[model samples]
Target: MTTETGFTNVDHEFFHRELDAFLPDRIYDAHAHMWKRDWASFTLGADIQNVGIAEYDRAIAEIHGDRPTETLFLSFATPDHLDLIDEANAWTADQIKGRPACRGHFFITPQQDPEWVRDEVKRLGLHGLKCYHTFADCSPTWEASIPDYLPEPFVAVANDEGWTITLHMVKSRAIADPDNLHWIQKYCRSYPDMQLILAHSARGFQPAHNLEGLGKLAGIDNLWFDTSANCEPIAHQAILRLIGPDRLMYGSDLPVSHARGRSLGASDSFIWLYEETPVWGEKHIRIEPVMVGLEHLRSVKWACWSERLTDQQVEDLFWNNAARLFRLDT
Candidate 1:
């Protein structure tokens, strides 16, 4: 792989040192996933599984090396975990051991019998709900993953129950079509009181060409996006400017692109958000690694975030906002 596009290899000295030295008492990483099973298949084309409990422990040791108070886990299972919603939540609950940072969004769909799994949802201490376009061979719109099913009262229940909803919102076929807007339109209209967090900054850093669809959804007040992998200039900057910081949250999509056997990569994209591109604008823009540090909260963004924002703002993003939104330990 070209050094320009391959995974970065930096001591990230400043970030590590700063995070280790200036530990926050209430910080919480909102977008990382936690699973204890072998997640090799999720690695896709990667050379290795890239994540596992051991590696996660090491990663937790490395980033949280300072050991922040808590972290809100975006619990998930492999594609294999989709169909068995009740089982998926049960597995993740065991993984969490019933803690906030160890928490997660239970997968939900209306297609099958649902199994609803209310008992498991309660037992698992589910923090929120997660829905993906790829699950059950489906799309976020009214389309069916099963070719005979649809997302319905299931979605309404999640909204009514006041569970945070995170949707994997950017892609090619599933996202770039008319069906893509259906859910947002339906959810925003149906559950006017719902809190919907869009995964990736309304679709990661879309160039000018792909901005319209994201922009349309921005009209919905219930719609929010996670900075998990939106560190790159395209969606990162645009979302900040267009969607505003209030609508954004930090996310690493951890281990997916990194080559771990359990967790996902720090991000699927944004490989160039900090390294090669000093600034992420048409020509010139402020390129603050600190902002990146604050956003990712684990890797190099720490040093940059410390330098860019006041100590309080850093704490706000790392802890306050997440605590208030997820109702986590403050």
Candidate 2:
């Protein structure tokens, strides 16, 4: 093992019994989306899930080896589809009713008035709201603002309710300034009360993109970031360093990538991920020691893939903080 971070030959078997308990009693996958039967839910990548709610449950059981006591669902829609807010919100809320750990987020857009969303939010037991930052659409309420299309009313409701929101957070030609995340901040400065979750660890703490903004986020108290789709090293570390533990949450953009992705392939992916389960508590690394490392292991073959953190830190990122943040009853 190299001294740098303790080298290990990691493969997909990296996801076994060790991670089985990292979540303690349970957890909340802070950033996730469910595609309804009407339209296949899609993340930014080429990956698409023809499967709907059931698939998410299977992912919680097999991949996480634990069901999320709650999952904050993001609306995976482009600008054109933003008007269907109520339908999308209802679909996710129904899924939540079916699963204990499920909650919905409105990908609020200015394309329509925020009153529809405000009304919907009141009807649903929502945990957060999502804003599409790259939208090129006209607001029914106000002028276009950074972080894209959210109109004044949507932000107003979020600011009033003390609810959490995640900006689409993709660095874009339209959104050249990450500090527009500051837009949420700018408004919150006046409200001094609303909460917002910047997605993708604010594009992985890129200095030009968002680190400064993340650093500044601490001042807002209401602004926080989620590690959704951010399993890479620099992103995690930057967040751990800047935002600290309480604000972070576990989010695997699952089915977005093979629930198990190994350069090797499906079978190897599983074998490599769950390698520790087959043996007794003693092995090359010792089951107990590596078991401590399990959550880190399951967090994506970080050993060979990326060594930005230690096994214990991963355990914290993967489940502990999530449990705390969501106040998962489990």
Candidate 3:
């Protein structure tokens, strides 16, 4: 699968030898991002300037081998370029157009007019919205206050439109923070029309935090969890057990998930790179790393398989569940 960027599927022989037999025929990646470098604000280094649909296609081909797949492009939210939201959404929607298997979600902020959002959703036929809490509307302190987590105006627009929100939970313990969990519960209950897909299994950076949060919120009908760039198998297994197969979906968080640098062998290469930078006038620091793995999508499959999920359960995780959520069948 070659594209304009001279992007071709790379050799992922290691992934094949490990999990080929265990994987399904195809996958529906519920979470991914795609855009030209100039159109976006974030950077992963000069060598990795762009990650358009071509790059994504090549990478997924390498990861899945010969298996076919579908992906939903979630508009990336950057802290510095809040103004890029419309442009980012337009870029994604344009790139994935005419490809039924591919769809895109736009990014939104409460700062924007809700009526404009309603019109844009109808005009673009967008699948959903990718909400970056810390960047869009929240102050990223050690502990977030629930009363002011997300903008109520944007929440109302999404609910009125009956749109899905792909939320990356913020705060100290990711999703486990008491205030964060309470905010999620409030949103889910208050906005019955809105569907919420918690990214990274509610940011299971620590498996224990993930389990704790999942235990508290698993029964919510409108809530779903995506296994996107989550590296821990223990947390993934816990997600399956607590949230059940119907509420779990496949997500790669690609390009970000694409393994980079020299081979540190199979096992070692699976580990992603992390850079720690001082922040808050050196009072605190951010160690945000692009979650990478040679087999991120496969890792999710491996987790499901290890838990002895039936073929039907695997089907739901990789395809049907996302299909139902995003109305992909239509």
Candidate 4:
């Protein structure tokens, strides 16, 4: 099941067989990350350590083969390393400087100054801002009563610049949580000019959560959702049925999602290139390296195909939507 291309699972083959092709003309990856090796100690785990620009590009090429693809790079969310927000943002700026196909989103801590964020975005030519309220143990706890992570100043700056905000929601129930829903509604109404992208269908890992959340937010025109790290079929079905393809964008959530192989429809940890799964065959059967990021890419492709989307819809999800949102076409 392993190939020299760095994929472990047969899913990629399955995708090709099902779709009658293994590659698309182009892939506008809406979500991806890169980090400095020195920041390893600050990372949440060893699997994510040593992930930098080179590794990120390798993962993308390994997944899509020779097909052309573009990446929108977001800094790795480091809750414990909030002090490194400026440094992380700067690092991303440096990584994408000459890479025309790549765009970077700077990270903003809850305590960051709005003027500073606005200044930094202009200084680094950042296309957007990323807000992570709950990603790790050091991340802020999700509560209905908590204040907006992006304060008024940051919101104002985003609106003024027409920049997108990629939000990874906090809380167990995700977008279905009453408190989160309330906040999103308020934010969308208050800042209609700002383009809001809800990561992972608002993190709707379960069917019911997807239904309730996407259904509730269907009326918000400014709100968009990205297919990043979300592999649930039912949620994707709901996304198409509820919000339509125009607002649905593609994201691989690379590096973190690519550090190892994962069992489909399971919460298992990343299996390294050298690790073996007994279920596959003999004990310690060395498994071929599988690019988990490709798993995400293939999964989204399957989602679009499953929905019986038109060619235009597929193009919109994978390319046009993200391009328009990020102003990449220009």
Q: After superposition, how far is residue 36 of candidate 2 from its true place, in Å?
A: 2.6
**lDDT for residue 221 in candidate 3, whole number 0-100:** 89
lDDT of 1 by residue, 51-157 (tens): 43334444544345455445545655555555555565566666667354555777665444434544456666775677655555545533443222225555566
Prediction 4 global C-alpha lDDT: 0.69
Candidate 2 per-residue lDDT, tens place, 1-330, comes to: 321122133422444433444343455567777765354444322333334576666544544555544567775665455455567767777777766656567656556667767777778777657776546454431234553565556667777776667765443311235446557667667655566666655644232333344565665566566655443444555556666655666665444433222111121111233333444455556542222123433443342125455555555555665555455675
Which candidate order results from sorting by lDDT in descending order?
3, 4, 2, 1
**What clash count goes with each model?**
27, 12, 0, 1
What C-alpha lDDT do the candidate models reach, one value each? Answer: 0.51, 0.53, 0.69, 0.69
**Model 4 off-target regions past 4 Å?**
1-23, 40-52, 135-148, 261-291
Number of clashes found in candidate 3: 0
TM-score of each model, in listed order: 0.66, 0.67, 0.82, 0.82
Expressed as tens digits, the lDDT of each residue in 1-330 for candidate 4 is: 554334545545643554336345788888887776554343323344555566566656656666677888887656666666678788888888887767888888767778888888999988888876653224345642224565556767888888888888766667778878877788778888888888876676555677777788887878888887765666677888898889888887765464455323333111223125444454768444444555555667677778888888888887888787777767
Better of 2 and 3 by TM-score: 3
RMSD of 3: 6.9
CA error at residue 100 for candidate 2, angstroms: 4.9
